[model samples]
Target: MQILIVGGGTGGTILGNSLARRLANEIRAGKVRITLLSASDKHMYQPGLLYVAFGQMTPDQLYRDEASLLESSIDFHVDPVTEFHLDRNEVKTGSGKTYAYDLLVIATGARIVPQEVPGMAEGSENFYTEEGALRLHKRLMEFRGGTVAMVVSLPHKCPVAPIEAMFLLHDFFKARNIRDKVKLQYNYPVNHVHATANVARWAKPEFDKAGIEYETLFNVREVDPVKKIVYSEEGTECKYDLLIAIPPHRGMEMVETNNLGLGGWIPTDRFKLTMNDHDNVYVIGDATNIPVSKTGSAAHFEAEVASDNIVSVIKTGVPVREYDGRVYCFIEAGFDRATHNAFDYINLPELKPPTKSVHWFKVAYNQMYWSTVRGLL
Candidate 1:
C-alpha cells in the first residue's frame, strides 16, 4: 500500500512520522510505503512567531530542517504538488513528476491574505510570516509612546493569538516603563472580544485589569494609511500609532485550483477526518472545514487519530476510533504566565487561571516540538 501525505507542516509531519513508526515492519517487508511531500525544506514552529514579534525569540530558533524531524524510514520530498488528480489517485508536482497513492492525506494548510482587505496590506504589520515578525519587532523597538491597536479578521489560525498579543503588548510597555504613555486597543469583528464564549469571559476581566481598551463588532472595512485611521464597516474608526492585524486566511491555492472545496477548505467528515464522499482521502489541519479552532494542537490530535485509524485498517481490515474534535491549546497570558484549554466535540473548554509554571511548560514545549514532530510526544 502506498500512502502519500502532502504538506509537511504540523499535521503531515506528525502523521508521516507516526505511520513510519507503526508500519515499520510492514514497510521493511515491502508491504507498506509512506511518502511525504512539502513545499519547503524547512519546517517552522509557527506558534513561536508571536515570540519573534515580541523579540523573545529570533527567527533562526523557529525553524528546523524538515528532514531532520522525520523518521528515516519515511520518504520525504520538497516538491510541492501543483495539481491533484484525485479521481486517478495521483498528484502532479512542481517538477512535473506524478505520483500515485492508495491512500492520500492532504494537510496543505492555510495562507494569510492581508490583500483581501482594502489597504490592510499596506497599512498594518503582521507577524504571521518570518519577514513580518522581524519587521514588527523593529517597529515595536522604534515605538516610543502612542496607541498600539490590534485588529483581527475572521477565520484566522490560532484564534487566541490576537488576545495574547494584547497581553504581551501591555507587559511590553510596562517593562519599558511607558505603560502610562502607550495606549493598547483591541478590535474584534465579532460582538465579543473573543469568538469563544468561555475565553471571552476569562480574558475580558484580564483586559480590564490590564487597562486594555477593546471594541467589538468592529469589522475592518479599510485602513487609511495616510491618516493612520482604521475604518470599520459599522462606521466606527480608530486612529493608531502602530497597527497590528490578524488578517483573513484561506486554504492553499492548490486546493482551490483542484476544486477540492470552497475557499480551498476541504469538505471533511468531522469525526473520521476523511474527505467528504472519498473514503481513501483524509484531510487534517486548516485544510479541513471542521468546526474547530485552527491550531497546531488540533492538527496534532487529528493526525494521531488519522494515523491510528490507518494503521488499524491496514492491520485488522477495519478502522478503529474516531476524532472527537479534541483540541488542547496553551494560552500565553503574558511573557511569564500562561494557561491552557482542552476540549472535544462534546465538551466545552474550561480554562484555568494563568500560572508561571504553565508558562514555563509552554516555553519548554517550544524546544520539545522537535520530538513532537518525530511522533515521540
Candidate 2:
C-alpha cells in the first residue's frame, strides 16, 4: 500500500510519525511507502509566536527544521501542492510530481489573508505573517502611549489568539512602565470569551485585573487606517492609535479549484477524518471547519485518530479509532499565570480546573513540543 500525507504541519508531522511507528514491520517489508509533503522547511511552534513578538521568546526559541523533524523512515518531499486530483486518488505538487495513495491525509492548516480585510492592504502590519510579526514587534516597542486594540476579523484561525495578544501587550507595557498610558482592548465578534461558559466566567476576572477591555459580539467590517477607527457591525465605533488585527483565514485555493466544499471544507467524518465521498481521502486539523478550537492541540488529537484509522485502512480497508473531538489548549494570562482549557466538540470548555501547578508546568510543557518533533524526525 502507498500512503501520502499532505501538508507537513502539526497534524501532518505527528501523523507521519505515529503511522510509521505503528507499521514498522510493514514498512520494512516494503508493503507500504510513507511520504511526507511540506511546502516549507521551517516548522514553527506558532503558539509561541505571541510571546515572541513581545520578546518573551526569541525566534530561535520557536523553530524546528522540517527535514530534521520527520523520522528518517519517512520519505520527505519539499514541494508545494498545486492541486488535488481526487479522481485519480493523487496529489500533484508544484514541481510536476504526483503521489498515488491508498490513503491520503490533508493537514493543510488555514492561511491568513490580511488582504481580505479592507484597508489592511493599505499596509498595516499583521501578526500572522512572518514580516508582520517582526513589524508588529518593532511597532510595540515604539508605542509609548495611546489605545491599542487587538481585534480579530471574522473566521480566524485561533479564536483566542487576539486575546492572548492583548495580555501579552499588557505585559510589554507594564515592563516599559507605560501600562498606565496604554489602553488595551480585545475586540471580537464571538459571544463568549472561549467556547465554554465556564472559561469565559473565569476569564472576566483576569480581564478586570489586567484592565484589558473586552468587546463581544462586534464584527469588524473594515479597518480604517486613515482614521484609526474600528467600526462595529452595529454602526458603533472605537478609535485606536495602534491596532493588532487578526484577519480572516481561509482554506487553500485547491479546495475551491477541485470542487470539494462540503460545508466549506472537504467533507469528512468527525472522528476518522476520512472523506465521506472518497475512501482514499482523509483530512484533519484546520482544513476542515471542525467544531473545535483551530489550535495545535486539536491537530494533535486528530493526528492520533487519523493515524490509527489510516493504519486500520491499510490492513483492513476500514478505520479503527473514532475521533472524540477532544482538545486541550494552554491559555496564558499575564505574568506566570496560565490555564489549561479542554473542550469537547460540543463547543463547551470543560468546567473542571486543572492543577494550579499548571504555571510551573509551562516550563516543562515546552519540551513536549520538541520531543514530538524529535520523535517524528
Candidate 3:
C-alpha cells in the first residue's frame, strides 16, 4: 500500500507520524509505504507568531526541519504541489514529480489573502507571516502612542489569534507605560467576538477590564493607507496610527486549482473528515470547511481520527472511526494569565477564568508540540 500526505504542516506531520508508528511492522516488511509532501523544509510553529509580534519569541524558536520531525519509515518530499489529480489518484509537484497513492490526505492548510482587502497590502501590518510579525515588532517598538485598530478581514485560521494579539498589545503598551496614550480597539465581522457564544461572553469582562474596545458586526470593506483609516461595508469607519490586521484566509492554491474546494475550502464530511466526492481522500486541519476553531489542537484531534480510520480501512476495508470536531485553545489574556477552552460538536465549551499557570502551560505546550510530532507526548 502507498500512502501520500500533502502539506507538512501540523495536521500532515502528526498524521504521518501517527500512521508511521501504527504501521511500523508493515513498513519494516516493505508491505506499506508512506510519503509526505511539503512546500518547504522548515515546519513552523504557527501559533507562536503572535509571540513573535510581541517580541516575546524569535522566528528561529518556532521553526524546525520538516524532515527531521517524521519517522525514518516515512519518506519526505520537499516540493510545492502544483496540481492534484484526484481522478487519477496522482499528485504533480512544481519539480515535475508525480506520485500515485492508494490513500490521500489533504492537509494543505489555509493561505492568507491580504490582497482581497483594498489598501490592506499597502497600509496594514499583518502578524500572520514571519516577515509581518517581525515588521510589527519593529513598528510596535518605535510607536510612541496612537490609536491601534485590530481588524479582521474575514474568517481566518486560529480564530482566537486576533483576540490574543489585542490582549498582548495591551500588556505591551502597559509595560512601556504608554497604555494611557495608546488606544486599543478590535473590529470583527462576526455577530459575536468569538465563534462560541459562551466564550465570547466570558471574554467580555477581560476586554472591559483591559480597556480594549471591541466592535462586532464590523466587516472591513477597505483600508486607506494614505488616510490611515479603515472602512466597513456597514458604514463604520476607524482611524488608526497603526493597524494590525488579520487578512482573509482561504484554502491552498492546489486545492483551489483542482476545484476541490467549495468557496476556497475543501468540502468534507464533517464527522468522517473525508472528501465529499472521494471516499479514499481525506481532508483535515485548516483546509476543511468544517465548523471548527481551525486551531492546531483541532488539527491534532482530526489527525488522530483520520489516522485510526485509515489504518482500519486498510486492514478491514472500512473506516471504523469518526472525528468529534474537538477543538482546544488557550486564550492568552496577557499579564501572564491565560484560559483554556475545550469543546466538540455536541458540547459547549466551559468558560474558565484566566490564570497565570495556564499561561505557563501554553508556553510549555509550544515546546512539547515537537515531541508530540515525534509521538513522544
Candidate 4:
C-alpha cells in the first residue's frame, strides 16, 4: 500500500511521522510506503507569528527543515501538487510526476486573502505571514500615538488570535508609556467580541477594564486609505492612525481547481476525517470543512485520529476511533500573562484566569512544537 500525504503542514507532518513508526515493519517488508509532498522544504511554526508581531520572537526561530522533522522511512519531496486526480487515486506534482496511492491524506492548509476585501490589502496591516509580521512590527514601532483599529473577518485560522492581538496592542502601548495616547479600537463581525461565547464573556470585561473600545456586528466593507477610515457592512465606521486586520481565509487553490470542495474546503466527515464520498482519502486541518477552529491543535488531534484509523485498517482490516472536534488554543493576554482553552465537540471550553505560569508554558511550547511535528509529543 502506498500512502501519499500532501502538504507538509502540522497535520501532514504528524500523520506521516506517526504512520512511519506504526507501519515500520510493513514498510521494511515491502508491504507499505509513506510519502509526503510539500510546497517548500521548510516547516513553519505558525503560532510564533503572533509573537513576531510583538517583537517577542524572531522570524528565524519559526522555521525548521521539513526533512529533518520526518522519520527515515518516510519519503519526502518538496514538489507541490498542482493537480489532484482523486478519482484515480493519483496526484500530479509541479515536477510532472504522477504519484498513485491506495490512500491519500490532504492536509493542505488555508491562506489569507486580504485582497478579497476592497482596499484592505493596501490599507491594513496583518501578521498572518512572516512578511506581514515583520511589516506589522515595523509599523508598530514607527507608530507614535494614535488610534490603532483592529478589524476581523470570519472563517480565519486561529479564532482567538484577534483577541490576543488586542491584548497585545493594549499592553504594547502601556509598555511604551503611551497607553493613554493610543486609542485601541476593536471590531468584530459577530454580535459578541468573539464567536465563542466563553471567550467573549471572559474578554469583554477585560477589554473594558483595559480601556480598549469595541464595536460588535461590524463586518468590514472597505477601507479608505486616503481618508484613513474603515467602513463596515453595518454602516458603522472607525477612523484610525493604523489598522490591523484578521483577513478572510480559504483552502488551497489546488483543492478548488480539482472541484473537490466549495471554497477550496473539501467536504469531510467530522468524525471519520474522510472525504465525503472517498473512504480511502482523508482531509484534515484547514483543508476540511469541519466545524472546528483551523488551529494547529485541532490539526494535531485530527492527524492522530486519522493515522490511528489508517494503521488499524491496514493491520486488522477495521478502523478504530473517531475525531471529536477537539481543539486547544493558548491566548496571550498580556506581556507576562496568558490563558488557554480546551474543548471538543461535546464540551465547551471553560477558560481560566490568565497567569504568568501559563505565559511561560506557552513560551516553552513554542520550542516544543518541533517535537510535536515529529509525533514525539
Candidate 5:
C-alpha cells in the first residue's frame, strides 16, 4: 500500500519515523511506500517554548533538521502542502507535485490563532508566536517590576505552559533579587486551576508559597496596551506592568478544507485511531478531537494504536488497537522542581507533590524527544 502523510510537525514526523521503521519489511517487499511532506527546513520542539520565554532555553536548542532523521526508506518532501485531494487520495504540495496513496494519515497538528481574539495578534503581548516570544522576553528583562500578570486565554496548546510561566516568572524575578518589586498573578478560565483536580492539588499550595495571586473563571476580553491594563467580560479590570498571555489554540485549516474530520477535527474511535469518517484515513495528535490532554504523550500513545491498526488492516482489513485516552503533563515550576499528573482512568491515583524526582524525569525527556526523532522510540 502507498501511504502518504502530511505536515512534518510533532505528529507527522514522529509518526513517519515510527511507521517507516515498523514497516521496513513491507517497504523492502514493495508492499508499502511511505513519505513525509513538510513546509519548512526546521522542525521546532514546541513544548520548549515555555523555557524559551523565561530565558531558560535558547532558540538554537529547539530546532532540528527534518530531513536528517526521516529514514532514507521514506521520501521527504520539504515543500508546503497547498491542498489535500481527499477524494482522489492525493496531496498537492506548494511545488505543484501530486502524490497518490492508498492509506493516508493526517498528523498536521493544530496551529494557534491569536488573531481569533480580535486584538491579541495586533501585538500587545503573547506567548503563541515567535515575534510574541521575543517581545515577551524583552518585557521580562526590562521589568523594573510591578504587577506581572500571566493569563491563559482559553484552551491552548500544552495547557500547563501558562501556569509554568507564572511560577517561572516568579523565579526569574527572584533570581534578579527584585522579587518584592512586583506582585505576580495567574488568571485563567479554569476555576483557579485546570479541568482536573490533580494539578490543582499541587498548584494551589505552590501559589500560596510563592505569594502569587490567582484568578479563576476570569475570561479576558482585550488588552489596553496604552493603559497597561486587561479588561474582562465580567467588568473586571487588571492593571499590569507586563502582560503574558496564552493565546487561543486552533485546528489546522486542512482538516476543514478537505472535509475529512469532525467539525474541525478528526473523530477517531476511542480504541483505534481509525477515522469514523473513512476507514482508510487515520488521524492523531492534537488534530484529532480526542478526549485527552493534547500533549506529546497522547500523540505517542495514539501512534502506537494507529500503527497496530494499520498493520492489521494490511493483513486482513481488520482494525486493531484502542486508545486509552491516556495523557500526562509534567508542569515545570522552576528552581529545579516540577510535577506531572495522569488522568482519564476509572480509578484516581494519588499525585505526589511536584518534586525533585519530577526534575530528573524532565531532564531525561529531552533525550526521549531526540530518540523519537531517530526512530528509537
Candidate 6:
C-alpha cells in the first residue's frame, strides 16, 4: 500500500513522523510506503512570527529543514502540487511527477491573499510570513510614533495574534517612552474581539488597562494608501500611520482547481475528518471548512485522530478515531506575561489569566514543538 501526504507543515510533519513510527514493521516488510510532499524544504514555526515582528526572535530560530525532521523510512518530495485527480487517486506536481496512492491525506494548509482587498497589498504590513514579519520589524524600528491600526481580514490563522500584536505594540512604544505619541487600535470583522465570547469578556479589561482601542464588525472594504485610511463596508473609516493587516485566507489552489469545495476549502466531516464523498481520503488543518480556529494546536489534535484512523483502516478496514475540533492558544500580553485558552466546538474556552510563568511556557513551547516533530516529545 502507498500513502501520499501533501504538505510538510505542522500537521503533515507530525502525521508523517507518527505514522512512520507506528508502521515501522510494515515499512520494513515492504507492505506500506509513505511519502510526504511539500513545496518548500523550510518548515517554519508559524507561532513565532509575531515575536519576529517585535524583534524578540530571529527567523533562523523558527525554521528547520523539512526533510531533517522526518524519519528515514518516509520519502520526502520538495515540490509543489499542481493538480489533484481524486477520481484517479493521483496527484500531479509542478515538476511533472505523478504519484498514485491508495490513501491520500490533504493537509495543504491556507494561504493569505492581500490582493483580495484593493490597495491592501501596497498599503499594509503583515506578520504571517517570515519576510512579512522581518519587513514589519524594520518598519516598526523606523517608526517615530503615530497611529498603528491592526486589522483582521477574517478566517485567518491564530485568532489571538492580532490581539497579541496590539498588546506588544503597546509595550514596545512604552519602552521607548513614546507611548503617548503612538495610538494602538485593533479592528476585526466579527462582532466580538475573539471567537470565544467569554475570552473576549475577560480580555476587555486588559484592553482597557492597556489603553488599546477595540472595534468589532469592522469589515474591510478598501484601503487608501495615499490617505492612510481604511474604509469599512459598514460606513466607518480608520486612519493610520502604519497599517498591520491580516489578509483574507483561503485553502490551497489545488482544492479550487480540482473543484473539491467552495472557496477552495475541502468539506470534511467535522468529527471524522474525512472528505465528503471520499472515505479513503482525509482532510485536516486549515484546508478543511470547519468552524474551529485555524491554529497549529487544532492541526496537532487532528493529526492524532487522522493517523489512528488511517492505521485502523489499513489494518482492519475500519476507522475508530474521531476528531474533537479542539483549539489551544497562548496569548502574549506584553510585559513578559501570557495567558492561555482551551476550548472545543461545544464549550466556551477556559482561560488562564496572564502570568509571567505562562509567558515562559510559550517560549518553551517553541522548542518543544521541534521535539514533537521529531517524535521525541
Cα-based TM-score, every candidate: 0.99, 0.93, 0.98, 0.99, 0.93, 0.98
Candidate 6: residue 81 Cα off by (Å)? 1.4
Clash number for every model? 0, 6, 0, 0, 2, 0
Q: Please say which candidate is ahead in lDDT: 1 or 5.
A: 1
Q: Where is the poorest 10-residue window by lDDT in model 1?
A: 146-155
lDDT of 3 by residue, 1-377 (tens): 99999989999999999999999988999888999999999999998888999989999999999989999889998988888888999999999999999889989999899999999999999888999999999999999999999998777888788888889999999999999999999998878887678988987787899999988989999999999999999999999999999999988877788888765699999999999989889999999999887788888999999999988887787888789878888989895999988899899999788999999999999899899877678
Q: Which stretches of candidate 2 lie over 4 Å from their true place?
A: 262-264, 316-318, 351-356, 374-377
Between candidates 1 and 3, the one scoring higher on lDDT is 1
Per-candidate local distance difference test: 0.95, 0.77, 0.90, 0.95, 0.76, 0.90
Between the candidate structures 1 and 2, which one is better when assessed by TM-score?
1
The candidate with the higher lDDT, 1 or 2, is 1
Q: How accurate is candidate 1 locally (lDDT)?
A: 0.95
Q: Return the TM-score for candidate 2, rounded to 2 decimals.
A: 0.93
How far off is residue 269 in model 5, in Å? 3.1
Return the lDDT, model 2, position 349. 71
Candidate 5 lands at a TM-score of: 0.93
List RMSD in Å for every model shown: 0.7, 2.3, 1.1, 0.6, 2.0, 1.1
lDDT (tens digit, per residue) of candidate 4 on 215-321: 99999999999999999999999999999999989999988888989989999999999999899999989999998999999999999999999999999999999
Residue 371's lDDT in candidate 4:
94
User: lDDT, candidate 3, residue 340?
Assistant: 83
Better of 4 and 6 by TM-score: 4
Instruction: For model 3, state the Cα shift of residue 286 in Å.
Output: 0.6
Tell me the TM-score of model 3.
0.98
Q: Which ten residues in a row have the lowest lDDT in candidate 4?
A: 153-162
